[model samples]
Target: MGCTTSRYATGKKKPVPIREIVVFVPSTRVPKEIDLRRPLRGSLSEGLLERLAALRAKVVALSEKWSLNCSTPTGNIATED
Candidate 1:
């Protein structure tokens, strides 16, 4: 049996469990004075920019999916289990 205190009450009003997720993104610092007009051909900057774009897309998708899953009703989740 569960505790009877109001603080320990079970049901929809109960606090939802939470887990922290951390993602480390590697990056390099560039000087502000770097010439923007310079071409990126055959340089590490080109590859880094491409990888950043891909990571941004993946992060956006994951955020959307997590929001949907967390907002779902607990009853619906329990039934599916």
Candidate 2:
């Protein structure tokens, strides 16, 4: 009998390479807290203000898109009073 080779592709031989990165932070450091309230004296820098506005817009958009009710607290999500 004669041997015939068919041109048919099989499963994926090489899978995607996933890298696990472990970051070890320093144990002790200066306590730096991010104050959410606006500056007492003057307005924040223009660049910072723009960034904060953009971030707020993104959050609102995401909440609307996923039908997430901000008032309803299901998990760790904060609810507005």
Candidate 3:
């Protein structure tokens, strides 16, 4: 899961050095799902559809455990603004 040195891979595929641990989670009340039932003209690519499905599943998993031990953000997120 990591390199030989104290470094972690992030963003791009290349390995890079990281100074500290960061937890990046979206903080917002779950939005209600609405099905507008919009039609599509052609079949979407299989890779795109697979990635979308994975994202949907991840959201569902996160939402289910979202209420358990939720903590208030204690630090400023903007490092340089």
The number of the candidate with the highest lDDT is 3
Better of 1 and 3 by TM-score: 1
Q: Summarize candidate 1's per-residue lDDT along 24-60 as a digit string, tens digits.
A: 4333222233332245445647777677557666666
Q: Which ten residues in a row have the lowest lDDT in candidate 2?
A: 21-30
Clash count in backbone of candidate 3: 0
- How well is each residue in 1-81 modelled by candidate 2, as lDDT tens digits? 333444334565554332332334333322244443366226677677767767766765665644544334455534444
Clashing pairs in 3: none
Instruction: Identify the candidate with maximal TM-score.
Output: 1
Q: Candidate 3 at 18: error in angstroms?
A: 35
Backbone N/Cα/C clashes per model:
0, 0, 0
Each prediction's TM-score versus the true structure: 0.38, 0.32, 0.34
User: Clashing residue pairs in candidate 1, if any?
Assistant: none
Please write out the lDDT profile of model 3 over residues 1-81, one tens digit for every residue: 333454446656666655455665656455466432233214666576667667766776777567443564466554432
Q: In candidate 1, which residue ranges exceed 4 Å CA deviation?
A: 1-44, 75-81
lDDT against the true structure, per candidate, is: 0.49, 0.49, 0.56
